[model samples]
Target: MPTLRDIMTPGLVTVDPQATLKEVATLMLEQDIGAVLVMDGEHPSGIITDRDIVVRAVAYGHDYGTAVTDYTTGSVFTMEADTDVQQAAREMADRQLRRLPVTEGGRVVGMVSLGDLAVRTGGSADETALQGVSQPSADPQ
Candidate 1:
């Protein structure tokens, strides 16, 4: 089995906690990614996903210029770069998270998604990564 460092996308794009939702959305679009790591001066602070924009920003009727810190999900779950793929998958399953940041010494290094795990574990579909996992609450608070 491959280590997370073997399959994770390195040099991930990150955003500031104080950045505007509009800025985050634009960065997502520009990067062609579904999520962005939120950083506090090089330390991982939180994460902002596309769902966050739709549910927390759009659905809540908050302006795009709203601060991302106001809507970002903090207390992010992370994994070390050298962690075994199975362990990483299990952690994601336990947390009911679709994505997990790969870190080293409290700094963001990369990110892993359900698709990445499925591909590594020989699962049929990326969606199967969520199997045997509890569903996380949709509420962002």
Candidate 2:
């Protein structure tokens, strides 16, 4: 029964919403992370993941110089630090999201990925949740 605080990648990586997709990609690479928060002051305005860049931006021939927020999941869904791993997994799957930002005291604290869930849940995780998230979508953005 690991909590999100136990397994999440502690520490937040953020970018201004105005930053270009290219810049966001560069940051993710430099940090060795798959997601970054688009911060609007102290709150998150959106979230962008490596998959989002590839599926939503690259696949669509979106200009690299366009603002990252344009491709971000603008209505961000986050989990509190103490949330159970299984609960987090279910929510992510239901949302068809691969990553989620972790929060504490209404502030970004860490990040969780499906990979984290797999490892923490002893690799079995949840097949239905995994398939739900991994399914292909024709979403334009």
Candidate 3:
């Protein structure tokens, strides 16, 4: 069983909380990622997913220039880099989350997603957790 530090994406894709939704969306698309950390300097303040843009900003008729903070998930869940991958998977399953920031000494170091877990440790449990995360959500964001 790998630690999160072994399998997590080893860098953060971040956006300033004050950035426009358009800017963040472009970055996500260019990076081919599903989520971006909303950073306040080196501190992570929130997260913004593609679902957040479509559900919160688009559905609400907010324009592209809208601040990312207006629709970003304000409270993010994180895991320590040393955490066991299975335990991290359980936390994500319980929260119905697809991504978690990986931290070291309380500083953001990387991110882990359902795909990362599944690919690094292929097993029934990881498969199930990934399926659960991939399921459509009514709340979207």
Candidate 4:
């Protein structure tokens, strides 16, 4: 089995937690990426996704200047870089998470996304994992 170290995108584009939603949205658009890690010092504190902006901020009638920490998913889950990709996929599927910060020695090293696993694994397992991750639930939290 491949390890996350082999497939995780090995550099993170991050923003400080105090950054405004507008700034985060602009960064996501400019980078053409759906997610950005939110940092506290050198450690990842949370993740902000495009969907988060729409659902958590805009839907709540928050102004663009609202701090990202006000809406970012603060209960973040991280995976070790050496963890098996299959296990990571299972965890993501189970948690309905699209992206996970990859860590080494308690420091963030990279990120693993559902799309990354789907593209790399290329099998029924990957398809199943993708489907699981994509299924919508009544709970959006």
Candidate 5:
């Protein structure tokens, strides 16, 4: 089984909690990533995703200049870099999350996404299972 360390995208883009939402948005766009890990010192504090920008900010009419920490989901779900990809996938599914931060010794090292796991596993087991059931039944005659 592949480990998160093998599939995680290292050198992940991170933002400080005190940074403005606009600054975070610019960083996301520039990095071409959908989410960013928010750090306080060396520890991962929260995460800000594109959906947060829409639902937590624009949809609610919150000002973009406001600090990102105001809108970020501070209760982060994380996995160790050496954790099995299957375990990470299960955790993400259970938590209904698309991404998870990879950490080592309380320090953020990288990030892993559902897409990355799917690719690394040569397509998800769930997908393969669904495909198996979706296939046509054999003729009874």
Candidate 6:
């Protein structure tokens, strides 16, 4: 049962809520990440993803100058750094989230993405179960 701090990506990449979509997109590209946390000063406000840019901005024809928060998804979700990584993974799946802001003492400390969870729990029970079903069964006597 690893803690989020053990597998989380520290040094989160964030953008101000007032930042333009172009600016956020630029940051994502520069960082080579799919998601960016939107912050309102010291508090997390929302999140924007590369897919959101393509779907909301491109599909809706929102100007690049539009604020990133204008089309952010749902609300910001945070998990304590000391929490069990499996718990965070479960919450993310339940909420249909790909990532979460990692916190300690109510202050943003890092980020835990779906990729991180996959890496952490890659070849354990879940993978074994998946393999049991996906692989062909041998002939039974």
- Cα lDDT of model 2 overall? 0.85
Query: Cα lDDT for residue 141, model 5?
Result: 9
Q: Give the best candidate by TM-score.
A: 4
Deviating ranges (above 4 Å) for candidate 3 = 131-141
- C-alpha positional error of residue 112 in candidate 3 after TM-score superposition, expressed in Å: 0.7
Local accuracy by lDDT, each model: 0.82, 0.85, 0.85, 0.85, 0.80, 0.77
Better of 1 and 5 by TM-score: 1
Candidate 5 per-residue C-alpha lDDT over 1-141 given as tens digits, one digit per residue, 9 for 90 to 100: 778899889998988889988999899889999998899988878899988888889887889899999888888988889898777776776566677899998788998876776676787633533343344546410
What's the true lDDT of residue 77 in model 1? Answer: 85
Expressed as tens digits, the lDDT of each residue in 6-124 for candidate 2 is 88888788998899999999998999988889999989999888999999999989899999988888889998999988788788887888888899999999988878877766765
For candidate 4, give the lDDT of residue 11: 76
Mark the regions of model 6 whose C-alpha exceeds 4 Å error after superposition.
125-141
Please give, for residues 42-106, the per-residue lDDT of candidate 6 as tens digits. Answer: 88898888999999898888799998888897567788999987666666655555677899999
What is the overall TM-score of model 6 with all chains considered together?
0.84
TM-score, candidate 5, is 0.86
TM-score of each: 0.88, 0.85, 0.89, 0.90, 0.86, 0.84
Which residue segments of model 2 deviate by more than 4 Å? 124-128, 135-141
lDDT of 5: 0.80
- Residue 16, candidate 2: Cα error in Å is 1.0
lDDT of model 4 at position 127:
62
Of 5 and 6, the candidate ranking higher by TM-score? 5
Q: What are the per-residue Cα lDDT tens digits for candidate 1 across 1-141?
A: 578898788879898788999999999999999999889897878888999899888997888888899888889889899998777877777677888899887677999988777776576334445873547556534
